[model samples]
Target: MMNIKVAPPYAEDKVLEIIDAFGHSGKTYWKKRNTIKVFEVGNDKWNVKSFQVPHLINRFAYKYVRKSKARRSFEHAEILLGKGILTPKPIGYVEYSQPIGLTNSFYISQNLSYDFDFGDVIDKEFPDRENILNQFTEFTYQLHENDIHHFDHSKGNTLMNKKSSGQYDFYLIDLNRMKFEEMTYEKRIDNFNRLSLTADMIEIVGKKYASLIGQDEAKVIDDIKKSCEKFKEFARRKGRWKKRIGL
Candidate 1:
């Protein structure tokens, strides 16, 4: 596995502590994790989100040497941007080492103009569902083709920018658990199986997505199932990326 590290900007900034410590009841901490705190600063010149660090989902023994979960999340965010994937661009981050510095870091990115998780639309009754399924099928195929596991693939973690016309533009969020290195068959199955539990419901979601993207269903169902497992084979992952890149 490649030694993952947070890119520049974050690596350079001296992590700032829970801020607005100087402003009006300006100090607000997150209730969920209770680790992060936020505040509006300088007439909202920019918003800051701060919090304690978290651990990697699978790798904890390397607590000291390996990158923290925060770093992985930020790294995937940055990597997706580099790959020209549709997502928010980072502004900067706050990194610190406990005791001496803030070990857990804070990543700040440009707030996407308009975005919502897929979960928001589900169970809301979209007239055309087949299209959504097609879009989702094609998109998931694309992701697997690229050998990206997106370990935390979920409604909340997956986001979208809604057009003023009420159309969706997808984006993935909360991406620390991504599996990007040397994908294996079992690993890929693990990824989809986790999703298969919701496959039927997701299929309905995909149908709507396909309609939204203006695709056909004549061959979509078969295609989706194949694409679902195709990437599991190393040959598929490599060949797909190669074919797409014209290699």
Candidate 2:
């Protein structure tokens, strides 16, 4: 928001053949955890996005996950899509192997134009903010209903695309830290609020979510609100208390 992004080197050469029709390419960001490169293509006109695969990151992520997880995260998108959740479609993914000294990956998806982070928009207003909020709510709900724990739910990872003539679309990025699982109501609800929205944003968005899904009069919504606080508090403590063993 405060600072606009710049393009990565070789952006022109890497311009996705399909997306070239949109316009020029520019602005690339290293998505958190080295999961992928989020590129801002084109200019002020109709800027698009190019997801350049998750190459490298060393942590609990890189060593532990097998190719199966990558497949799951991508296939997982289909589940969300089926539930009416809006996210960038995973067209394909590249891989790395021992035979090759170096490995790289690229995930191709059409950029959701008009998309920006909530942190970026806090200082500005986008039309259909309510719709954006509602869609976001459903997205979180879907993740929880299915027990997909997004290890990092920060506002930065949660992006909103506001179209001038239509409703906004919500996308969840940074899959490396996600904890996909089947869990109880409390854990699922708590997982949804672990890192993203602030207290107020969560309350407002959570309420909007309840309204969109059902009546908030029932305590389910209130329970979710409380769980959000609890989860965040736990994640905060867990992060601070970790020890660097055998590092």
RMSD versus native structure for model 1: 11.2
User: What's model 2's lDDT at 227?
Assistant: 73
1-247: candidate 2 lDDT, tens digit per residue: 0111112332433434424332244344443434333454354122233233334452224324544244344555555567565566554433333331223333444455545775563332555555666566677777777667776776677777665666656777555456657756566456555545555556667686556546563465577667776766886777777743422
Per-model lDDT: 0.50, 0.52
Error in Å for residue 78 of model 1: 1.9
* Clash pairs for candidate 2: 6-27, 7-27, 24-42, 53-106
Give the candidate number with the greatest lDDT. Answer: 2
**Candidate 2 TM-score over all chains jointly:** 0.57
Rate residue 87 of model 2 by lDDT: 62
Cα displacement (angstroms), candidate 1, residue 170, comes to 1.0
Can you write out model 1's per-residue Cα lDDT over 152-196, one digit (the tens) per residue? 665555565546543556677666578776555444334443333
TM-scores of the candidates in the order shown: 0.58, 0.57
